[model samples]
Target chain A: MPYFAQLYNFACWLIGDRVAAEDLVQETMLKALRGFSSYQQGTNFRAWIYRILRNTFLTSQTGLKATASLDSEDDALPEPATLETPESILLVRHEQSAIRSALESLPIDFREVILLSDVEEMSYQEISQALGVPMGTVMSRLSRARKAMRGLLTAASEGVKR
Target chain B: MTCDTWRERLDAYIDDSFPPEELNQLEEHLRVCPSCAAEALHRLKLKHATKAAAAARFAPSSEFRSRIAQGMPSRRKRLFGDLWIPGLAVAAAILIALAGSSVWEWHAQRQQALAELVDLHVTTLASVNPVDVISTDRHTVKPWFQGKLPFSFNLPELENSPFRLLGGKLVYFNHAPGAQLLCASGKHQISVFILQGDWKFALSGTFPASAREKGFNIESTRSADLRILLVSDANPGDIHELAELLKAAQQP
Candidate 1:
């Protein structure tokens, strides 16, 4: 019950539908409840459920497409601009709705990392558990996601010139 | 540490994931290096903005909460339960494990404050009579809290906007009495809470920082000695617009 809301929100963001997210969360909870014995004592409960939720999504209709795109151009990504520049300083406006579009436009892998790291404030280790990947992968994905986001937001703000 | 090395550790430093030994070393380095400090500030702002951008996330309705809650077994360990019949309690347990076992102390405290605020919002929603004072007029709503709270606040004129003032009630946040005004845009209800600014340090950094509690979007900012929070499942822009109005109302 404590983190029920966070799970539902994460599900909604991933599934992009309130109704589907609700079903997915129920299914995740039910699956966990049934698989309780399988849950190792030391495994993070939060990350374990998040992994189950993602696995559930992958098997579901909408998240199936996410798996296909998972291997999309990790190395082909453009090098991101650093925060050291004066021009980049002005691009960091929190109120820019363009940021939402920029975030939405990112690849699913990048978007998920951004959501887990930034929005949900999960640590690298926790995100690794949620993603079932090494900690290094989490770091790289987060780095690339921010870089990609910076690229998109910079372009967006320039277009609007606000 | 070299700036390049510091730059690599910047995200970890900003995220507060690096070890305490490295944390102090990094802070010492930042103290002498203006360039690194500016870069750190810039990186922190981007992180803030990215998090702020995600304020548009969907909030689950109370019905969903109830449905899931009721679906789970009330008191069973469910350790050996059949996999086909699942329950909601297990999921809740996992999500609550979100509390990083080793995270900084302040992070837990801030999360607690955000959780409390969310709980207060949820409690209000479930109540039969949500508001103590019932009136849409800003003039009436503003006066209702006159000595009930330690401080006073202004309510925006929602004259031609899509928003309508529903009413307000007195709330106790962190054991401090305050005012919570209910408003609506379209079908979503928004709770605008004005509380004594005792925990200002919890929400450090910029005035208007955003946080998530459950699935709700919360935009909180400080005005004078009062802290204003707007919570709703409404879109981020709508919540922000209402937040701006509240801030403007406080201004001359």
Candidate 2:
């Protein structure tokens, strides 16, 4: 489902570990299901679900003590391994992975806003609600996140050229 | 404005959050400043990359769905044998009388407690102290709770799910130490509170089991000696499913 994948991708990016991200997402869904009756209909379900995912990620005990790191060096990012990919599709996948790695390498605050805005396609207001921050904060964070992502991607590209 | 100022404003300009005058100024500055122009182009590329990465969505595997389903409490099982029918009828009859007697004192206390929890929930939504500790490892989250509360709580990592471990914070609910677990689903936030108490004291036939106040939903359930409360604006069905999954994870 779009809902599940969106959450999963956000989780993977947030935690930066696929295995841990998967577990956190599962718990998030479980909690979401239990509290389904309280969800307001016709409202922003994505925002609501995102809030749950954020909270679940924060409280999980798995690696809470590990200092937050921005290193994407260890991330075994999903590569396009399917056979018979058109050259264009392959190019697009490569670009996507590069961008993903760059995004993942940014600070948590930066990564969060970028994912919400550019990736998740959340409006500034929706991001403010999900992040429990002011709209200004969302805008500022997104701006910074984008800048950081650009710097990382540029650096990664240069490194590849060497 | 100088190039630096224009560069700073580039983000707002790109997002179209700037006023018309400011936007016009930024455009003029970019036209004259090649450095700023190049930076803007790079920023656009980054934005495109982010969009492309986000657009590549992945679905939850069938196994994950089955696992979540298995984790939830079976409503059908709860409905079998008309188990709660007699209890519900009896509860209905005594509801009025129970409101008046000291025999319902504990229920009143529990209601007050829930109200306090609702207050805490609202404050958390408005505050920045969502988690006291942040980590992605289960070992990190589990031990962090030690000595932070009057009792021990287990936090199993469900990395296979959408909820990634953002962090944990220590909070007080009803003057008792409570642990707040933070997890995320996409951009959504969910707060899980595990309280140490005897559920029997709180469920004494009078207190409402679940209620939605303000815009948030609060649900409490008991497993053995632990009482868990999930607070969010997410669908109640999702919360219930999460509770069941949590219960399953806690099992041996």
| Model 2, span A7-122: residue lDDT tens | 87788777766666667676566445434434558767888678767755644443233223333323333322321222222235467777767665666667778888777767
In order, what lDDT does every prediction score?
A: 0.70, 0.61
Over A42-116, each residue of candidate 1 has an lDDT whose tens digit, in order, gives 757887778667656654556656545554445344444555343254454534466667777777778888888
Candidate with top TM-score is 1
lDDT of 1 by residue, B1-252 (tens): 589888777888778787887688989999999989987887787788767767446677877676666665434232222223434444544454454333223443455456446545654554444576788899999998898777888888998888999899876554457888889899999899998776644345433378765578899887777788888889889999998889889986
RMSD of each: 23.5, 15.6
Candidate 2 stretches greater than 4 Å from native: A17-19, A40-43, A66-94, B31-34, B65-252
Interface RMSD of the candidates, in order? 15.8, 10.5
lDDT of 2: 0.61
Q: Relative to the true interface, what fraction of contacts does candidate 1 keep?
A: 0.34
lDDT of 2 at A153: 56
**Top-lDDT structure, candidate number:** 1
Please compute the TM-score of chain B alone for each predicted structure, in the order given: 0.58, 0.54
Q: Quote the B-chain TM-score, candidate 1.
A: 0.58
